[model samples]
Each structure stands twice: as structure tokens, then as C-alpha cells.
Target: MRIRLQPLAASIAVAFAIPAVAQTPLRTLDEVVVEATRERDLPGAAAPTAGELERLRAATSDTASLLREQPGVSLYGAGGVSSLPVIHGLADDRLRIRLDGMDLIASCPNHMNPPLSYVDPSNLKSIKVYAGITPVSVGGDSIGGSIVAETRGPDFAQPGQGLLTKGEVGTYYRSNGDQRGINLSATVASENLSLSYSGALAKADNYKAGGEFKNFTATGRGNELARNEVGSSAYDTRNHTLGFALRGGNHLVELKLGYQDLPYQLYANQRMDMLDNEQKRANLRWLGQFDWGRAEARVYHEAVDHYMNFGMDKQLVYGTAVNGMPMYSRGRTTGVETKAEIDLADSSLLRLGALYQHYTLRDWWPPSGTGGMSPGTFENIADGSRDRAGLFGEWEKRFSPQWTTQLGLRYERVTTDAGDVHGYGNAMGNQLVDAAAFNAREHKKTDNNWDLTALARYAPSQAIDVEFGFAHKTRSPNLYERYTWSTWAMAAVMNNTVGDGNGYVGDPDLKAEKANTLSATFDWHAADRRWELKATPFYTRVTDYIDAVRLTNNAGFNVLRYTNQTARLFGLDLSGRMPLGNTALGQFAARGLVNYTNGKNLDTGDDLYNIMPLNTRLSLTHELGGWNNAVEMVAARAKNKVSDARNEVRTPGYALFNLRTSYTWRNIRVDAGVENLFDKLYYQPTGGTYTGQGTTMGINSIAPGIGVPGMGRTFYAGLNVRF
Candidate 1:
């Protein structure tokens, strides 16, 4: 149904309202009347030129391809969908992902649940990404950054009358040779409740690499392909989610359940190839407000059953035929958290929270070669748990009506416990090393972190709101980085050595990492209401920064261990939106963004590895007669700075262009767009190379190395409707 408002009545109401004298009008006229929730905005230097939600929802290719237009993001993989996101030079577990209020952990060695694949863009209402200095509410020690995906919410109207249902379905076919996909989402909402669901299925054949690849061992001997061109195995994915919510005056309750299954081929980064990844999760939350305070409580549970194997039939293999050898693992996690906020006085608020989590890991390695039901060693079987609690408070006061200052402080304590586990060494050795005896006995410790923040804002004139902020934050190490013992994936192996294969192992006694952050932001609105701008500058100094370090040993294979080092980084971000006025062509607008970050490893006197290069985005959008059209251009410089003490790879930069248009008629909407218009052959400045080799080693011989080059041109179109 189409609803229309009385234009004459709106015009008359606006004309009778008193206008601000010598000041810019607010973006929305009734802004002051609406309750406001302060949202953490992206630091000026890491914001994307255009968001990925819409384009990604209708993507025909992989998640990485859909997001390539954004600055400082990169992907690398054999096929399209398998590529992962590299933000500010970090990917994998380094980046923290949050769905609503819970954390989703990926248990697959090959990273089956990258942030994009976990939540189909079609199901998202909005996504806010903070490259750094994310709010404390998100929790988790994130050295890289954070991505938050929020689902649609209930739409309530005038006390008792509300009905709404909306859904969208889309499919795309690509010419790149062998890939296709379908995506769908639907939602229904009433005054008291809402339901939403989304699903996506994708498939792709092997990819043709732009360079040659080598099949060999670490000793410089094995299969070799002069020119690298091969396709990946066929892979498929299915995901579904159901959510329910109840809302009353000051209390809200939400329940969410999610299921995901991906039966896929093994990639190069994995030790064993995965046959299936089944994941299940449940989440519950209750939030309530009281006369003097507010409280939020949450609980979450998740499980992962992963299946993998070793298969031999590749032409790159030297005259050999091997059957699949199956291996499997099961991972389970349960957590509960709660927080309370008290309104102490007119300008002060106290916050307190506590969290508890338990994790169990077990894996089985089936005996190989014979193929019969033979039981292999169950090398690792460990149970771990963590308990965390924190206290924080914020104080805000206005010196005058136009000036305000705020201060905040927080303290947290974390304790961990883990069972004993084996150590890392050559599994193929003729004799076993009693290395397990030397491994540090399992134990537990309590780590503490502190945060302090201060902010000052001044509205000298109604047209401008200037602000400045300073904060100091610290983070602890994660379980995986400090305790994982695994083999190298084929992709990482082939790329790390000219033919010398190797992999990484976990360290049990790793120390906690720490960082101190400082930042300032400015918001300005032109007196004429024709322009808006925002800028932020920040600097961070990290001591005992943790990293997966590759040992320089030249034995038969490579070995990696985790360690802590010192580092420093600084950057700037600027963005603006301007109105260009109506023309014979149409009503036009312009928006642009620029971001840059530079980092260095003080311990080794080298630049931080995988840092994104300086990048910028500009776009022109036009609107006329129910139609919206836009053209965007993006470009970035290559990151020449690199770590010399560790294995670090440098990525070259490139420029790209895209176009989008949409038409709306009543309850129907259509969107279409073309990406990488010029089909430029460029690479992400932070894209990772095959993981087997450290960065100091060259990747010229690795298959699909040089970090998968950016994809060629592609196009997509989709439709939405309400019923």
C-alpha cells in the first residue's frame, strides 16, 4: 500500500516555524524531539567511499569482489567466494566481528565464515565498521579493527496500529567463466515483534591465475607449472536465521537462532581440505530501564563440526593417484554477559559488567594410505574457559549552554584456564620428539586492562559543532594466536617457498599485547546549509604487540611462532557531503572521502606489514522523478613501507571505477550497477600472500600468489517488493 502526506499541510507547518538567525538548520527538523543514541562513527581515515551492503546483496561473484571498491580492503583466494577481507593489513582472526551483541567464531582452518559470508548483505539493516579504536561495548581484544552487522528491527506506529512486510530476491550470472549465485531476504514487523530471514547459495569453478605456479616441497623439488592457470574445486554455502523480539515501554527482549553449512573444497591456506562446515548458534538478550538505571543481559552458545580430507588427482602432482583421507574436529563455546548502567546524578553515570565463557576443542585424524576405518592419533584435546568482569563510569557537564566536557574511566580483569596439550614439530619424523615434556604445563592467570577518555565540544555558533577527544586503551591476546598448532595449507606452502614448504605453530606462553590511543575529531556545517564535513586524526603506540612470526631456520621446512613486539602508528581521515543544486540535468550532490595510516615496528626498525596505502573516493549522485543515479571513482597508492625483521609483503596500488542506478515506483524498487568499469588489473595494498611462507621469502613461484589480483569488470541488478 502507498501512503501519501499532504504537501500543502507540510509546507504551511514549515513556514510558520521560527527560523534560526544566522545559523545552519539541523539535518532533520525534529532532531531535538527524538531520543538520541550516540553512535560511534568511523575514524575519518578508514571510512568507505560507498557502503557495500546494497552492492554486496546483489553480487554475482565472491564477497571480496563485491567489496573491492572500498579503500584499504583486499582479498586473496583460488576462487571468488573463498577470498577473505584484509582490513588495514589484517585478516583472519585478528579482526573482531560482532553480530548484534555476540561474537561469531570461525572454526574452519580455511576460514569458511569470513565476515561477509556470515551475514548475507541482504539480511542487514545497516553495518558500521570501525577500523580502529572501536567502542568498549564491543569487547574482545581487536588489534586489527571491528565490523558490526545489525539486522532490521520492528516498525511500531501510533500505540496500536502497525503492519509491514518486505522482501527481496536476487540472482546474478557472471561471464568470468564459471560462477553464479542467488540471494534472498524477508522481514515482517509489528508493534511488539519482528521476524527476519536471509539465505545465499554460491558456486564457482577453478580460477585462471595471471601468473605461473609451482608444485614442490621446501627442498626445491616437486611438480612445477610454467604458467599458473587452474580452477578451484566446486564449493557451496547455505545459511538461515530466525529472530524474535518483544518490546514494551522500557524493556526489550530478543531471541535469535542461526544455522550455516558450507560443503567446500580445501584451499591453499589449509593443512587439510574441508568437505563440510556445519555451524549452529543461539542468542538471547534482555534490556530494561528503571527509574534510576538501565540494565542489559545476554547469553550465547555456538558449535562447529568441521570435516576435511587429503585428495590427490591434480596434474601438478608428480604422477600419483591418492584417495581422500578424512579428518574432523568439533568446537563448542558458551558465554554469558551482563551490564548495568546507573544514573548517579545530573551529569554522571556508572557502568558495570561481567562475562564468562567456556570453549572445548577436539579433533580426529583418520589413518591414511590404507583407507580402511583406521583410527589416527587424536593429538589435541583441550578444554578452556575465560572469566571477565569490568567497571566503568562516564561524567558529562556543560560549562555553558554552548560548551560541554565529558570524562570516562574503565577497568577490566580477565582470567583464563586450559587443559594440557601437545607441542609443534615434524609430524613426519621417523622418531617422535618428547617435546611434549618440555611444553609449559597448562595454567591460568588474571590480566587487567584500563581505559581513560576525555572529550570537549563547543558550539560557538549554531552552524558548527567542534569536538576533540583523547583516549587510552589496552587489549589482551586471543586464544588462537597464542595456542594454535597446525600445518600449512597448500596455498600458503606453494607461495612461501620457491618449493620449500612450511607452516605455523601456536605458542603457549605468549604475553599480552598493549596499546595507547589518542584522537581528535571536528564536525562543521556551512551557514548556508550547503555543505557538511568531518575529520579525525589519531595516533597509537603499542608495546608488546603480538604477531605470528616465521622462524628463519632453513631446515627441511618452515616454522612460525607467536611473539610480542613494539609498534607505533598514526593516520588521518576526512570526509564531506555537498549539495550541487538542481540543474537542467537533475538535482545533484557530491560526496568524497580520504583516509591514510602509517605504521612501523619499533623492535625491528621496519614499517608494519600489510598496512593499507593512502586512498580516496569521490562520487557524483543525481536524483530525478523517482530515479537515483551515481558514478564513483576510487584510487590508492601502493604501500612501500614494510617490516624487515619479519616476513612482510608489500602490495601495489590501483584505481577503479563503478556506476549505480535505482528506480522506485510505489512498493517496487529496482537496482543495477557495474563494478570495475575499466577491468583494471590491480592488487590490494594489504592483500595477503599464500600463508605458507613468511613475507621475507619471495612468492614468485607460489601458485595464485602476489595476492590474488583484483577481478575484472562485473555487473549486477536486483529487485525489491513489499506485500
Candidate 2:
């Protein structure tokens, strides 16, 4: 019998760009290999193929938005382009994000430009997400698992063949926000050399909400009323990359240079917005294969300069003078990594690697008219630096045809230091207790951390497989978590990853966080590979988890201090797919996924901030000659268990429907979709507080407390052509 696999809406839209490859015959679970990691499959791992990535990119310009549908994944809204991904309730620096071969760091204090923002989705070739219990060889200094994104690699012509050229162009538009974007890429290749260039531009107006209207009272404008326009939610961005590659007998080397410019991006969850942002990056890599082993090495550098201020939407309420103060931050990262895979005894392999990184950061605010101190700068972090070095080894062995096992270990040394930091005092230039105490203490610290991983896979029958994994992971505190010296209102608000509108002061004496995770996966598949079902359950305990403690409750703001606490997290992920026999009308299929996670501060007996609520997605798909369509339903449970420390609010449960269809004609393809079909008004459980200053009359105002509102009904369409 021939097995037929159905493609979902996201994957079907890209079928025209690149035809899908034939699937290989099913093999025993012990023989399954993950192409991205070059290792056996791990529990709760998802890797989208190239075609699926292309289709997903056509729908949204934000890189993080692509992961929203994946199991065990949720998004923390910040700016239009800076949505942060959360896995099992861990976010931001708590997770290791690998872009291409480089470990990129967030440059902004507000984390405006995360690692994923560096690479546009239009240029991505593949993405792999390890939800929990990640392999030691692939990640370090993180407990939330790892995300790896790679751009299209060089493609060379066959030997004795002539020069080859390829190019693609695409454009998309969305109705709700009047958003528009364009992407272009071109490549030229010879037998020995290849060159490529890609670029993208995206812009959007403020998105509209889904409710009624209210007049503005803060601005004292009786004529002005907010019907549904979400305040401070507009953005404009551009990215460009140039790459070159050379191939020799058994070795290949590649070089890539990238530049990004974001002129303006409003943040709904922060007090300020990104005004000017720019980044420059360069990466050099070498890959070689020999009879004995395979070797890979990479060196990369990144420089970022960011500026933040008030946006036009917020100025209407606070006035331009009061919110005109501009904040500046600069960051630089230089890193190198080398790894080798060696052939050991039969059915066994060994892998070794080493990595080093040097990072520096500076955040300061120049004198401004509306500021407390004029003609003097407030240095949030001065000459802050962190250096890390790690070494790791892994061994994989097959004990028998039915069983496979792997073990890995890693050691990392981290050192961090910062120069004397200063804060803006009251008009008298007298320091507050938080700043005085922090400046009087030592500024240097070091940590020696270790990680361990053990995993095994057992296949008792062709249709049944079981996998178990255990991991011990460690992460040193980030510079912001250790070096922010001020307890002032503005300084206290900078130490945040959940976008909660609160102030925080860092504690330089905090210890590194360590985590232990245990996870298991069960997979059941048909003999012909037509359908599959997978279930995963995981538990984690963290010692010295970095959290916030309320220090003082001011009239308008609450001051928080960073502290360490014990935390626990438990979660389950379930996914399945089945094919309905083909009929004369078309081929039909059904697929669904459900995810649930609970996180708590074991020491404080409080719910963790920004924990995603239970959610599920179900879809029905239809395919015919050159046409594919899908209808999907998404549902989420209400979030009532709020975090008192962060003053988080509860959100009501909601359900939404979406419809998508795509058609392919030769080298040209068209995709169209309608999201939030019923125009339901809801809020995402993970979306943090609304910090945009606006009239208190509207439901989504800066005052009276409001969560980030979801976008209203939206219709989008796109076209792509390849030659």
C-alpha cells in the first residue's frame, strides 16, 4: 500500500516554491536521526522543513510569530518585531538562541532586538526547537531548551556544469493594520564558488482593536475618541544580507555579512518605544569531512546601537516635552566555536566541542530638558563585560538493534564585571539606598557551571517507540540581572522579560540558576508512515531561580528587586495526525495539537508571571490539483491564577477560527487567509500589561489596568514568483 501524507495550510502554501521530497521508508525508532542536530531524536523536538518555513513567512514578518503554533511554545508581546518566545514559562536570556552558527545576544535593555530578529524569516532555510531536555552538545548556559535558525546554505553547480542563476521575489499585504512587506533574493553559483544576496522591508500602521469607542480625557480633547485603534503599535523595519562561499576537495568555507535598520517601533508593554535601532553582523564558517571524522568551526561578531523614546501615540497624552527623554544602549559580541565528530567502534560515535564568547554592554541617558538631572548623564550600566568559555563531549552507542543510548557532559566558566555605576539623584544629587548600596559593593563575580545529559530510546515493535531523557542545565545571570545599579523609577523598570510595567533593581551578589529536567516521549505510527501520534510529559525543578521581590509600592509605580527563589514547572504536549482516504472531490486530512504548562515559585507559593494557559489547535485540510485549503480552530482556557508580585491580571478564555487557501501554478504561487474570522475580542494569556500612555476612558488605557488586546479580524494575501 502507498501511504499519502497531507500538508497543512502553512506548508501547502509553499508547495509552489519548492516541491516536497519523497519520504524514506519507515525505520526502527533506534535508527531515527535528526538532520538538524546530527543526533538521535530528543523528546519534544520540532523542526519545520524548508517549505513549511516559506509558507509561514508569507503570513507574518515577525520571526517569533512563526513559532506561535508549535507545541509547548508561546509568545510574549513587546514591540511589533520583538515578540519573545517562551518555552515551559522560561523566556529571554533563560533560553539559548543560536542564529546561523553564532549565539547572538539581545542588545537593548528592553530586549527590542532578540537573536531571532537578526535573521528575517524570508531568508530562513530551517528552524529547530528543542522544548526540554536539550542535548548537552547543542546548548549551554540555559535551561529552557534551545532554538536554532539557519539561512539558506550555498548551492553549487555539479562538476563540469556551467554557471547557474536563481532568484525569487515576493510581496504581501494585510488589511487590518494596512501592513505591507516585500522580500527579494538572488543567487549565482559556479562549480567552485557561490554568491547570494537577500533583502526585506516591512511597515505597518497602528492596528485596530475589536470593541466600541471612548473619548480621551487625559488629552482633554473632547472630539478625539478611540474606536479600536491600538496605541503605540506601529513599526518600520528593513534587513539586508550578502553571502559568499567557496568549495575545495573536501572542505567548504562561507562568509556572511548582515545589516538591519529599524527606524521606529512602538512597544505596547513598555513605558518607552524604540526610535532608532541598527545592527551589523559578520560570520565566517568552515566545514570539512574526512574518512575519520567531520569538523566544523565558526567565528562571528555583532555590534548593536539602540535608542528609545516616546512614540506619537503616547505623546498625545503625556505631551512631547515630558516623554522626550531618550535612552541609548550599545552592545557588542565576539565569539568562536569549533566542533568535531569522530568515528569510534562499530555503531558508536564521539563528539567534542569548545566555545568562547566576549560580550560588552553600555546603557546611558543623555541630559534632557524634562529629566531630573540636566547636563549630566545617568549611566545605567557602565563598561559592563562578560566572558565565557565552555568545553563539552558526547558519546552515542547502540547497545542492540532495539535500544540506543547517549551521554554527554559540559563544563563552562563565566566571569562578569562592571565599572562604577552612577544614577540620577534627586535635584540635590543625593543617591538613593538601592544605588548607594550597589555602588558600595564589589563589582566582579565568577561562576563555574556544569551540565549533564542522559537519554535512551527503546523500540519494542515497528509501531511503538518510547524515549526518556534527563538533563542538568545551568545559566549564569545576564548583565542586566547583575549590574543594574539604580533603584530609581526608570532603572527599576529595565530589568524585565515579561513586559510587565514595573520597576526592578538588580542584585550583583545573586547566584547562577541551575535546573534539573526529566522528560519522556511515546510515539505510535502506522507501518506505512501515513499517520503518527506523539505524547510528551516533562517536569523541571530549578534552584536559585532568578525572580523579583516587591521592595516598595509607590503611588504610580512599584519598585522590585531581583532575588533568587526555588521554582518548579510541569507540562505536557500532545499532537496527532490522520489521513482520510482520497475522494473524487479532493484529499482530506485532520490534525491537532494540545499544550499545557503550570509554573510556580516553590519558595513563595505564587504563580509564575506570564505563564501560558492551556491551549489547543485543530485543523481540517483539503487538497486538489494545484489547490489546497484548510480551516483551523484555536482555543485557550481562561487564566485566573495571577501573579501578585508582578500584579498580573487575569484574561478570559476565547476561541477563534481561521480560513486559508493557496494555489500553485508553475513557478508562481498565491496565498490568502482570514484570521480571527469572527472578529472576536480577546487577550492572550501571555501578553503582558499595557504600558502605553493614553486616555483612561478606553478599556486598553495605561491606567485602570489592561492586558494587551489581541488584533481584530484580519485578511491577508501574498504572491511569490521564482525563476
Candidate 3:
């Protein structure tokens, strides 16, 4: 099946959203092995069977990497387990990311623990991507769309079948970073009760680039980093989850517990590293089916303990703390959600929902010893709190089989506040003056944000479909963006989230961002859906966009403060797939896609930072018996339209190829692949500045104009067995 979502007229098909989707029998994917599977559901990956998840897990441990194949989606390179996702031209806090009905925020100022990083790829059951326009029921408190991720759902044995049991074990290795990992899951069920558990562990050392990217071999510490090595790129992580479910005549109840422990995840673009991070989560949900329709209610909570400082590659500086410039962050989140769906007369449907989330965070650097690090603890963000309460409604009706339309509205009340903060010293580094100025200001803020979506879809014939939509969304600033009070270079530099090798201060009076977008999609396909083509183009204008301005006169990595401005973004996505016919030995197919985006600051007249350049991918796939294979080509154009404000780096165009093969038997499977097959070297356009080593605390300490390099050629293989 070819499921291509449109760009315009958000008919959300969130006019057709997952929250309101019925749980019918989906594809089993048991007959073939695909490198990755596209969801049959429009606009999202709401459903994926075990077979699909297994195939995706065989090659990578990074969960964000799984979505790279999706159109209109890009990534910001970060730690091994954490990568920020970009939809259209917005990223990070600009979009909504949900895990098991819960909205998780990054606790670390450096954004080392993005929401997706908490769930290991091996443990994911399904992930949905709502690319551009979105309906009120599917999203709130965000300007862009949404990505919803969930674990395996509950399962029950048939009556009179006694107890049922099943499990899977898998392992994989990648030669480039010496990466290795193991995963296991077990489940037991009865007619009315089910219990399951899943766990994964992965670790790796620094990886090398295809070719030398620098001249220095020293890390400015007692460490050695070869010219071809990407320093601060190593990581060790483990994750575990347990779930229980109970079902009765017309209702189902479920409880889930999740935990993650990442001892360390070095960063190639930032000075600080995640030395230790721990997350604990619990969620409870209930679903009931009634004559009127369906109803759902859920409550979830999450707590985090995070620590950061210099890693092995970066020179350790400052304080009496054992790990150098020790930073600590503790956060807690609690939320409640409820929704109801009503089936109206004449194929009309109405959805109404309400949600509330409360969050608290404390970020501080304990006094270590000497210089500015002595006297007192540095309070980056003290007693910070952000709360949101939202309500949404949607109306959808299939006027006929060939015509469908949807409309939605959402409103959110966001409030934020913080306690007084202080620096380490009274005079050193202007700690006294800056701290006094910040402490005297009132820190409370509130915003009443609104969102609206209008969409329509038409299927003129079996071979043609058209969809278009318009959306207006709003988002308030996060704690790190509005309450991180500091102007001292050393203190501000440690608070960066964009990894640009710059210091960043926060503004308390920043306004919420509002965006208006226009979009449309045209799809053409064969009657049987074996061959398909899709084109999507979109444009968005934003008011009070959160940009930044220089706070200091220092050149290259100076202090900057968060501010508001006007901006515009436009983009296109093209994709097509067709059967190449069958032969005596195998069946062949072709698939290709292209993505292009341009963003500008209307106020500053400068290009937006980290906008992905034009890129394309093409692949030839073949299948025979239980064997499946593909040869892929990936290329990107030169990134010369730079962001002068951020002093973004420029890179030349480049191309690389890859080979993949997989074989599946009754209960066993094996996968092998070689990436960057020819060992081509390249820099990541969105990977941000390189501050992976040396004495990185001082402004302009690291060399300028360097971007994080892509990984070198790698050989990877995996094996999985199910019983």
C-alpha cells in the first residue's frame, strides 16, 4: 500500500488522526523483509508490527535514525542516543514529541536527553510522524506537527487456550565506532491479563571520519585524538520497561514503568558532556468503548537526574568538584489527559479532549574550587516551573467516499515562573552585577495560545487524490529560553542547547511564537497501488519567532540573548516508487525522494541557522525467496546560503552509496550492510559547530569554521531469533 500524506489543507487526516483510530488488524509483514516499512496510515506511522520493528532495529541503535527515510523530516546530530528531529523548518521545542501518551521535555540545558532518546529503538513498537499541518486533537503548544511513539501494546491469549508465552532476543555490531548492543523482550498473557518486559544495552567509543578533518593530534589534555577521529563521540546506555494490562467486557486498563541510565554520552559539538543521566517514568491509562463511541483517560509522571562536565577528550578545568565544572539538573513532570469521540449522524464525527501538564526544574553548578568557581554555587535556573492546560475539538465527516473534510481548534494556557538566581562569586566574572539585576526582576509569565486547522481531501478516481489544508499554531518559550539568567561568559556558555560553540543568556519578557502555514498535496498512483508518486509544497510565516542577538562584543562564539523576530520558511517534498517487473531470479523495484527547504529571518534579513540543504536519495531493491537486498545512493547540494548571525559553516556537495542484504527464515533473521561504501568524506550541514576537544570554556577557544564530520565507512551485521 502507498500511503502519502499531503502538505496543505491539514484535513489532519488529524482530520484522520491516530488518537481516534480504530484498532483493527494491521499488516503482519511476515512474508517479506523490508529495510524499513512505511505506514499504511496517512500522515503518521500509527501502526508497525514486530516484523517491521525488527528489520529497522537490525541496523541502528539511534531511534531518531529510523525516521530519516520519511519525507519532510531531517535531524540535528547530537549524542549517540539523542538527535533532534526537524519537520519542515522547525526543530526541538518547536514540535511536539509524545511517548506513550506523555509529553517529555529535555531536562539538560544542552538538550542531551531529548524525548525520543528515552526509548531504545529495540523497544519501540510504533512511531507516527505528522509532518506539516496538524489538527487540534493531535497537537497543542507547538508550532509544527507531532511525532507520537509507543511501546508494544497489550496482548491476551484466547479463551480455553491456557497461558501464552513469547519472546525475542537480538544483537548487532557496527565496525566504525566498535558499537555493540543486545536486546531481549518477554511476554506472558492470559485471557484477561498481560505482562511484558523489554530491555536493551549499548555502548561505543569515538568514531572516525572517512578522511582527516583536522591537523592536531592532541586534545589539549593528556589525551590523543587522531586527525580522522571525531572526539567526544562515545556513549554507554541502558533502558528497561515493564507493562501490565487488564481487559474486561468493554474497558481496558494499562500500567507502564520505564527507566533509563546513560553513564555517559559525549558530544562532538558542545563543550559539556552528559556524564550521568537517569530517568524514571510511570503511566496509567484507561480506555472504554460505549454505544456513543469511545473514551480515554491517562496520567503519567517522569523524573530526571542529570549531570554534566568535561569528558575525557576535553581538558578538565575549574573547581574542587572531582569531574571539573560539575553541573547538575533535576526535573519532574506530571500530566493528565482525557478524550472522547462521538459518532454523529451521517458519517460525521466529533472529537473533544483536555490535557494538563506540570513541570519543575533546577539547574545549578556547585562550587568546585579556585577563581570564579569558588565562593558559592552557580544558579543557572533556580526553582523553575512551567505549567500548561489545553483543550481541543475537531469535526470530521466523509461527505462521500470521494470527498472528506475536517476542522479543529485548540487553546492552551501556559504559565512560567522561577526563583531568584545567583552566580559563584560577587565580583569575579561580573557575577555580582548580573546576579543582582536578574534577582530584582519579577519572573512570572503567562500566555493564552490558540491553534486552528482546516483541511479537505478529494479522490477524483482510483488513480488520483488531492489534499490541502491551512493551520495557525502557537508555542511559548521553554524555561531554558526565558529564565536562564546569566551574562557571564563561563556561565552562559554552559547553557547552550544549539551546540553552536556560543554563550547564551535568556530573556524573561519574550513573547509566545505564532505561525500561519499554507500547504497542499497531489498524489498519483496505479489502481492496485503498486506504483505511486506524491508532491507536497508548503509555506509558513511566523510572528515573534525566538531568535537571538549578541550580548557581548567578543568575536566568534560571543554571548547572545534569546529574542523575538519575524521569519518565513518554505519547502517541498517529492517521492515516488514503482515496480521494475519480475525476472526468473527475482523481482525488482525502484524508489526515490527529494527534499528542499529555505528559511529566512524577515527582521534580520539573514538565513535561518541549521536549515538542511537540498538532498535526494535513490535506491534499487530486489527480492527472491526469503532474501531481500538494496543498493542506495544519497547526495546533498552545496550549503552556501549561510546564517550570518550564527556564523554557520559552509560545505561542498557530496554523494555516497550503500549496500544492504537481509534473509529471513521461520523464526530467525540476519542482516548485513556497508555504509559510505566508497569511504567518501563529508561534513554534516546541520551537525552544528565542532567543540569536541581542548580547553573549550573560553570564548573563541576552539577553532572556528569547523562542522562535525560524518562517520567513515562501516560494516554492520545483526541476528535475531523469535520463539
Top-TM-score structure, candidate number: 3
For candidate 2, what's the RMSD? 5.5
lDDT of each: 0.53, 0.75, 0.82
Indicate whether candidate 1 or candidate 2 has the larger lDDT: 2
Q: Rank the candidates by lDDT, best first.
A: 3, 2, 1
Q: Rank the candidates by TM-score, best first.
A: 3, 2, 1
- Give the best candidate by lDDT: 3
TM-score of model 2 (CA atoms):
0.91
* Candidate that beats the other on lDDT, 1 or 3, i.e. the better one: 3
Task: Provide the lDDT at 432 for model 2.
Answer: 55
lDDT of 3 by residue, 244-263 (tens): 99988888899999999999
Q: lDDT value for candidate 1?
A: 0.53
On the 0 to 100 scale, the lDDT of residue 497 in model 1 is 12
TM-score of candidate 3 versus the correct structure, residues matched by position: 0.94
Q: How close is each model in CA RMSD to the real structure?
A: 7.7, 5.5, 4.4
**lDDT of candidate 3 at residue 716, scale 0 to 100:** 93
Candidate 2's displacement at residue 477, Å, is: 0.7
* Candidate 2 lDDT, 1-723, residue by residue in tens: 001111111121110011111121111111111121222122222333333445567678888887776767788887877799888788888888888778888877778889988777777765656775677777799988777767767878887879979888999999988989999999899988999999999999878766632333232332332656667788999999998999888788899999999899988777777898999999999888789778889999999999987676654333444435678999999999999878675767787999999999998887664546454677888999999999999877677766777788999999999888666545432345655677788999999999998887777776766778889999999888888766655455655556777777788999999999998777776755467777778899999999888877543347688899999999888777778879999999887889899999999999988888999999898989988888999999999877788788688999999999888788888889988999988887888886655542122234634777888899999888889
Give the C-alpha lDDT of model 3.
0.82
At residue 19, candidate 2 shows an lDDT of: 11
